[model samples]
Target chain A: MEQPMTPEASLRLIDEMLQQAKRSFSRMSFYFLLWGALLLVATLTEYAMNRAGLPNGWLGWPILGTLGGIISAVHGSREGRKAGASTFTDRVFMWVWMAFTFTLVIIIISCVQVGQRPGPWVSILTAMPTLISGGILRFRPLILGGVLFWVFGLLALFQWPEHGALLFALALLLGYIVPGFLLKRQEDGLRTA
Target chain B: MAFAPLDPVLHNQLRLAVISLLVAVEEGDFNFLLEKTGATRGNLSVQLTKLKEAGYIAVTKSFKDNYPNTLCRITPQGLSAFEQYVKAIKSYLDK
Candidate 1:
């Protein structure tokens, strides 16, 4: 007959479960890197186009949007297939980002309809997911990144229209690229050690 | 001088490990539980059956990549039982 589970053993198991959950969710930095790089290119291109008096330079937005959508769909489906277990936190994270994506799409559509640049709206709204995600994960870097998003977001909003693209690009660099790389390093360390 | 009885169903080490994991994450799959517990396939399977019989867990069998997959989730009864088990263990230790 098996021995009864001791209190010490139960505590150990709980610790293991927590560790597993953390390991599973902590490997999401690649998404940050991917989206950040795309947005950086798009924003810089928009800025250049406006400066050069190029017609349809803003077409970068639609191109980037289509490419991003395809990449996300493929990456997400692949991740879903590999995922063996999911926690409540994972579900909450998915919904939070989903809402953010939905809101962003609506804003973009409205901007297109009104013949307005979506730069300011994009910059400000980008903070919501990062802020909430950081809060949910209790990760300080992500929290700080989200705050930086808001700071740059405000600059994008209040600054001259010509500078809006530049501010948005800066936001992506500080908010997404930096945190994404940090997370990637952390995950790598965890996997190695 | 009295101590609460440890639940017979949850008293075993592997079984307790399984429930503890399920309690933490709303659900997990067979391979995930196996990897976490570091238990042999046969032993884990038996423990899972015992938990299912006691109404502490629900198991769903589905196919993935042309392979049979088993997913397990803790039932409400299992959650209550786990809570009670923790309380009972604490009482024993406090004495």
Candidate 2:
């Protein structure tokens, strides 16, 4: 026969287990870093090509976007399999990004049909997931990243066409790349500590 | 107020620990629960079976990379029971 736990002990155990589960989902910085770098490269390349009066500059978007999608799929599936367990937080986070991706694709296609730039729309779309993710992770930097996206998004919408790509690139740097690195550092610290 | 009785199925230490973990995550495999609880494999297996039999959790057996895998997920009934248990515990503590 096993001993029974008092209410206090049971409460403590519940708290401890919840903490452990939370830690299990900390390895999420990789996606932010990966997508940020890819988008930054594509945006800068498109901007440079547009400046140099080069043809096919817009091709960078499709090429890099496809590559990012492939990498995200492969990496996400592999990590999911390795995790052995999934949490409600994990499912919610995955759906948020998936919805973002689906809507972004539609926005881009619609913009292309109307011969309009997708920069502002992309920026606006990026903010929601980033902010929601920050709230989910309880990380301030990501939340700030989301706010930066909104600011840059509005700027890209209203500013001159020539500056749209620059603003987009800047948003990726601050909104995705910087916070991505911060999240990675935090996860590393937790692992090592 | 009268004291409500604790659910015997959840009053044991190991069983309660297992349920506590399952309640937090969508699903957890045998290894995950074992790692979190630091219990012997046999002991964890026994407790998992008990919980399953009590309708507190659903257990599924599958394979991963050709290795056997056991996954556990808490049922809605289990969640309701857990909520009741917590309320009961709080009532006792209020005394």
Of the candidates shown, which would achieve the greatest DockQ relative to the real structure?
A: 2
lDDT digits (tens) for residues A5-39 of candidate 2: 78898788778877777666737899899999998
Calculate DockQ per candidate and list them. Answer: 0.58, 0.63
TM-score of each: 0.91, 0.89
Runs off by more than 4 Å, candidate 1:
A1-4, A191-193
> Across residues A1-193, which tens digit of lDDT does each residue of candidate 1 receive?
2665677676666666666655555356877888899889988997898799888877887798779878877887677667677778878877887888889889999988998888888878888899887787677788888888778877776766668888888889988999889988887877665
RMSD, every candidate, angstroms: 2.1, 2.4
Docking class of 2: medium
Clashing residue pairs found in predicted model 2: none
Give candidate 1's error at residue B14 in angstroms: 1.4
Model 2: native contacts recovered, as a fraction: 0.66
Model 2: lDDT of residue A81: 77
